[model samples]
Each structure stands twice: as structure tokens, then as C-alpha cells.
Target: PVRPLWAAAATAPPAGAEWVWKATNDVLNDLYAVLRFEVQRGPLSRSPSAVSHANQVYPKLMPFLRWWKQQPDRPPLYYATLDVKGAFDSIPHQKLLEVIRPLLREEDGYLKCPYSRWCGKTGKARTVYGVVTKERFGDVEAVRERGRRLGHGRGSFAVFMDLVEYRLLSRTQLLALLTRHICSHV
Candidate 1:
């Protein structure tokens, strides 16, 4: 199961809060760690402008800004911070899974469905989890556009998943699980 950790929002109203999930005794934590390691070390980290940690931002951005200031005809430089209150909800789950599918395939031998032998409410061994719904919110670009507008230009299409309840056994089911989760949170 997952535990929730809440913190007061930095700039939102006093009643607002932000949260993240912390896994405890999760069977998939090892897989998650391995996936995170592989993803961080892979192409994602190779981007010249990619800065994962807060400390890296100052070290990375300051020099570039300084160099730009010294240039003959430098365009105006601007920096802005975003309020990512509902960031996770704005991303499409299907597209997110697709982006990570290739990476997931790379770990094929190491990736096995943890709920392969688990039973659902049907009282039978279930190979898949979650239900499919025809309820469509909007397109990926539309969702991203809303996120960009809400976040003041910065956006991402990454969706968080609960590995225990909605195992990655089937893409369709996973999408439904993620969609449901996002809808509830939003």
C-alpha cells in the first residue's frame, strides 16, 4: 500500500495542500527503483538543459544567463516559476504509458506482472486490473494546453501509477486505472 505525505502549498491559499505517495513494504519498490535508475541514466538525463535537482538549477542557469548578457545581440531572458497544483491530472495516462513502454520493454526479463496470480472481484485469477470506461475528458494536446496555461507555460505529460492496485498487466486497463485516479484527484 501507499502512504500519503502532505505539505502546505508554497503559494496557494492557506487551505491548499500538496501531497505525494510513499511506498511501504511494496513488492514493486525494487522495480520502481530500477526503472527510475535506468530512466535517469538513459536519454532523459542526456538533455543539455535538463536539471533534475534544485541545486543544479542555479549552477546550470546562472552561467548561461551571464553568457547571454555578454553576447552582442542576446534576446531578452526571462525566468518564471509555476504553480503545479494539479500537474499530474493534466497528463494523459495512455500516452505516458506509451512513452515508458520502450523503457519498460528494455527491462522485460526483469519485469513480471506482480498481480499475475491475483484474483479480482470476480473470484478468479486475474491477469489484469481496473475497468474500462468510455468517458473521455479531452485530447492529450488539449490537456497539455490547459496545463501550460495553468502552469504559466511549463508542462509535462507524465502520469503516476499505483503499482499494487493497478498492475501493468494490460495497457488498456492501466489507462482506465490512471484515468480514474486522475479524475478523482482532479
Candidate 2:
């Protein structure tokens, strides 16, 4: 079951307002980790200029800004800041799923253990354990090589659970809901 936990916002709102945080169960969190990994490795990979981590924002931009300002013929420089802290709340879940579904299905891929033990046959399994070492320490490179051997390792399914106030939905029912519409138009 998903739990809702509320924490104080950084700054209080002018009027009546509250913040609610949705915390997922362990199983859902694990599922999310896998989804996030695949989404990052495959579709929706971040651009080099993107500053996703708070600690990275200054490090990434400061040097560039310094060099640009040093340029004698530099044109007028401008920057913009957007407060997207609450942006997700404005996005509809169904629409969010709709946007994600195509990205997940873009490559029509599946999930397999990175070790390849579960999905691979004898003499067929791909293992990075022996291949990658502390000297190399290049798991990302190894994963890319694995992708060349395998196909694009993108996700084939997207799961969404919208929890109402006091309702609890079992994992089985959710799985059923996920596959329910597959054959309707087939």
C-alpha cells in the first residue's frame, strides 16, 4: 500500500495550502528503480547540459559562465529560472502515462538480469562480473556492450497506481488492469 506523508514546505504559502507526499511501498520502489534505470539508459537520457543534481548545478554552469564572460566579443548573456517543484501535480496521471508509454515501447524491449543468468542459456549467458574490474570500473560501458550483444534494453511495460484516500489495491489486480486493454482492439 502507498502511504501519504506530509512534510513542511521550504516556505509557507501566502494562504491556506498544504503539501502531501506520496510514498510507495518497497515493491513499488524496487519497480521504480528498474524503470528509472531503463529510462535513463535507453530513452529519455539527459542531455550533457542538463543539471539534474542540486550539487551539480553550480559546478556545471559556473565554469561555462566564467569562460563566456571572459570572451572579449561575447554577446549579451541571458538566463532563465523556472520553478518546477510543483509541476508534477499539474500533470494528469493518464497523460503522464500516455507520454511515458511511447518512450517505453519505442524500442519494444524487455527486462533481464544484468548478470544474464536468468534469461541466458548455458554458454549463452553474458556476465560482466569477470569482464569489468576495479581497474576498468566501467559498468556503463559494459552495459552498452551488453546492449550491442543484446538489443536495446528498454522497458516494455509502464505501471501506474492512483491511490485514493482509503482504498488498497492488490498487486494482482494492478497486473490485471495493466494487461486488460491489450486484446480489446486486437
Candidate 3:
């Protein structure tokens, strides 16, 4: 959720766009706060046995578990874990657009994920300018190479995740349930 102040300042606001801008700003702030908190908390404990157990019980649970543990105070040693059902894919596209539109400067503005590649579908390659690069589109490998070249120093990854999460998690709530687990002694 790293917005370029210069970009926001340079943009000419549309008529009566204050409400939209304000809402987008709020969402961005929330997303930033959540991510910062998670990173500061660091990764959760994941012993080999525990991971093996999760893998055996639910094959797809490992990824989710890894993601969950990376969140701030996610394990809640003294509280039960809370899972937001269908967290992704529930976010409204319009809301995401509102948050991203101002940040885009070029004519295309938003990054275009062609329908062909929308669902991991592949077809002819296309090119799109993004916050990270300005060049012709090549194959997926080229795109990945460009990304690696850019690295993660400029907050591109954060912006990408923000856009993605905004698309998912429509109605979300956090509930704290007490648990007997404690790790202070460990």
C-alpha cells in the first residue's frame, strides 16, 4: 500500500471525487497496517511433524496454514484461530478500481490480465506497462525475468498483494477464541 505522494499530488481530481478518493485512501491504510503488523510479528512455528500432520489431514492446508501463520498474532497461543471463509474472490472489482485508478498514470492505467490468462489460461502474449516496468511484453518468462530484475525493493510486491486481497475478502470479521496453548516456556 505504498502510494507515491507525487503521483497523487500531480493527478487532477475528477469532479466530486472526494468521496471515492477518501474511501480508497482508507482501504489502503487498513491494508498497510495489517501487512506491517504481520511482518513485524514474523513467521509462526511450523515443526516438521506439525506440517506433516496438516499435509496428511488436508493436502491444500499447508499453503493456507503458512499464509495464516505469517499474519500478526495469527496463532493466538491463548486464543482459537479464526478463518475468514472465501476471503479471496469476494472483494468487489469496483472497489479495487477505485483504489488503483488514481495510482495509474498511463492511458491504459490498470494492468490488463487478458481473459486468456485470467484463469491461468494461456494464449498469444500481450504487453502491458506497469508500475514496475516500461517495455514491450514478451513471453511469461520475459515478464518474470523483468520482475526479478526489478526485485522487491520498490514496493511492487506490496502493491500487487494489496490489489489481490482487495479483490478477495468482502465481509470479514475477527473473532478471538480462547485457547489453552502457550509457548512462553518454549
Name the best candidate (by TM-score): 1
Backbone clashes (count) for model 2? 0
- Candidate 1 C-alpha RMSD relative to the actual structure: 17.4
| Candidate 3 global lDDT | 0.30
User: TM-scores of the models, in the given order?
Assistant: 0.35, 0.34, 0.18
Backbone-clash count (model 1): 0
lDDT tens per residue, model 2, 1-186: 322333455676667644544442222332233344445565324644445456777877788788888999999886533212222345544554454344333232332223332232222333221122222233455544544444323332111111212122333433334334222212
Worst 10 contiguous positions by lDDT, candidate 3 = 173-182
Strongest candidate by lDDT: 1
Q: List clashing residue pairs in candidate 3.
A: 78-179, 80-177, 87-169
Rank order (by lDDT, best first): 1, 2, 3
Which scores greater on TM-score, model 1 or model 3?
1
Query: How does each model score on lDDT?
Result: 0.40, 0.39, 0.30
Which pairs of residues have clashing backbones in candidate 2? none
lDDT of 1 by residue, 1-186 (tens): 323434333455445433433332233343443344345657857855556567789888777777778999988776632212222444565655455445543422322222232223333332321121122122434433333332231232222223444222333333344455545544
Residue-level lDDT of model 3, residues 1-186, one tens digit each, is 333223233476679553222322232332332232233233432432132223353654556667777898765433222111111234443443343333223232112221111111332222222221123233445444434433343332211212231111111210100011111111
